[model samples]
Target: MVIATGTLLLALPVASETGQPVKIVDALFTATSATCVTGLITVDTPTTYSLFGEIVIMALIQTGGLGFMTLSTLVALLLGKRITLKERLVMQEALNQLTVEGVVRLSRYVLFFTFLTEGLGALLLGLRFSRDMPPGQAFYFGVFHAVSAFCNAGFSLFSANLMDYRGDLLVNLVITALIILGGLGFSVVADVYTKRSWQRLSLHSKIVIRTTMWLIIIGTLMFLALEYTNSKSLAPLPLGEKVLASYFQAVTPRTAGFNTLNIGDLRPVTLLLIIILMFIGASPGSTGGGIKTSTFTTIAVAVWSIIQGKCDIEIFGRRLPRGTVLKALAVASVSLLLVVTVTGIMLVTEQEEMEIILFEVVSAFGTVGLSAGLTPQLTVAGKLLITATMYSGRVGPLTLAFAIAQRLGRQGIKHYPEEGVIIG
Candidate 1:
């Protein structure tokens, strides 16, 4: 419904720079991308959109990033409406919280933290941008980029998408910080906010922080090493800038698509590394998408446990629930299926090669907007296919599965005897 309204508004003549009506296909695609917090754009945002349209896109990005449920709850609370049990349950599901208790309080924290972070981020960015742009223009750019980065919605006013800022440590650091904060998931942030010590953190929080740190460290090292000789990407830059660029490239694929490096020019090895990072995107309940770091970590631990002949998956001196393991498997399986299915469809319909198409499909599924430059040339049908993929990716596999599980529950609950099947 939000996407549809945004599409309609964007399709208006007032939304376009030339005062000409936007194409329905492009409008729908943009709406979906913005609302899904997927940064893929068919049209150049700054040149093609008016300020009105940009605002709408940003609004969609915020709504989608924090989630509509969170926003609606905010409104409800502001209006002094008592949040009912049903409303709390819906928010619990939306935020992927473990329990029904304190979900409203969590929602409140989510909203408050979102505004505070984005505001501070915008201020820092504005100060840096003012040196180059007029105060108003700089402020505008700052607010937009801050919101985009914080939402992990990679939509940029600049057509090159932060390429010009490759050497600017101020811009790079601020943007990347916003991305990391947003992608860390509200729950994790809140956990840290409430409990500032390492030992006091929940096991889930510990794993997320640890995995995130390792990924950024490893990714930075690998990118700096791999792209050091590639003139088109990192080679021509100064040593300091190269490291900064490498670090930005490493972190952005955790479902934040603000790229300082040219994604297309990277070697196959770097792209594969990025693809793995994108697939194992941000933490759960983050503004970002992908199967999530938790799901990836859970799967890895489960596999390792099997290899070690352990009956239980253990982490941080605690045994994980079996349901968590099952859900992780379900998420990974569904995500892989979606990516494969979309790639197959694009292969049949589009003219792009296998690697490029796979990249695009994974990008859409991961809700990461870093494209290999194939978005502009896709047909209307191809765009529609990607739009659906973006929606599914943003909503997530487990959410859809849970909805189905609810439907199945209504029919009747039944349990059957376990049956053995041959294994590899």
Candidate 2:
């Protein structure tokens, strides 16, 4: 519904710079990308859209990043309306919480943390941007980027994204911080905020934090090593700038999408590594999207358990539930199927290289938004395909599957004699 509304708004003549109604296909693509918080664009954002259009995009980003239910809950709170059990359950589902208990309270924390973090980010970015432009323009850029960064929506007023600010320490630090915080999942942030110690945090929080930290660290080092001598990417910069750029690149592919380095210029190995990171994107209940870090980690541990001939998957001193492991595998399987199916279809429909097509497909599925300069050149078929991919990524493949399954009605499980088929 939000995407539909945004599409209509963006299709208006006032939305374009030339006072012409944008093509329905382009408008739908932009609306889906914005609402999904995916940075893919069919047209140049700054050049194609007027202030009204930009504002509409920004609003969609905000609305999409934080799910609509969260915003509706905020409205209810402001109206002094009590959150009933049904609303709590909806909030639980929306926030990906395990239970409805304390979901309303969590909603409060989500809003508070969102505004507080974005405000500080805006202030810091505004200060840094003021040096490059007039105060008003700088402030506008700051606020826009801050919200975009915090929401993990990679929309930029500048055509080059953050490439121009690649070496600027302040911009890199502030934007990466916002991306990391936003990608951490609000539950993890809330856990850290309330617990204030690692030992006291929930297992989910612990896993997410550990997985995120290790990903960033390993991704940064690998990018630095692989692109160290590649003239197109990290090679031309000084050591410090190289590391900085590598770090920013590492951080962005985790569903953040703000690239300080040229994504298309990176080596194939680096791109493959980034594709892996993008596939295992931010945690649940966060602005960003993917199969999720937790799901990825769970799958990894499950594989380890299988290799070790263990029946149960254990992590962080606790055995994972059978259902939890199954769900993780289910989500990963569904996500992989989606990516593979889309890439296969695109290969037949479009003329892009296999690697480029795969990257675009994964980026769309992950909602990571980093394109290899192929977005603008995509055919109408490609655009619609990616638009659908973005929406599915945002809503989650498992959720979509479950919705379909529910509509098919419940089936009773039959007790059958168990037999082993074969082992691979």
Clashing pairs in 1: none
Model 1 lDDT tens row, 1-424: 9999999999999999999988999999999999999899999999988999999999999998999999999899999999999989998889888788999999999999999999999999899989988999988988999999999989998889999889998899899999999999889999998999988999899989998999999999999999999989888889999999999999999887888877889888888888888888898889999998888888999999999999999988989887778778888898999899999999988998888888888888888898988888898889999999999998868586566445543544676899999989
Model 2 spans with C-alpha error above 4 angstroms: 398-414
Each candidate's TM vs. the true structure?
A: 0.96, 0.97
* lDDT scores in order: 0.90, 0.90
lDDT of the structure predicted as candidate 2: 0.90
Clashing pairs in 2: none
**Candidate 2 per-residue C-alpha lDDT over 305-389 given as tens digits, one digit per residue, 9 for 90 to 100:** 9999998899999999876777787888888999999899999889988889889889988988999878888988899899999
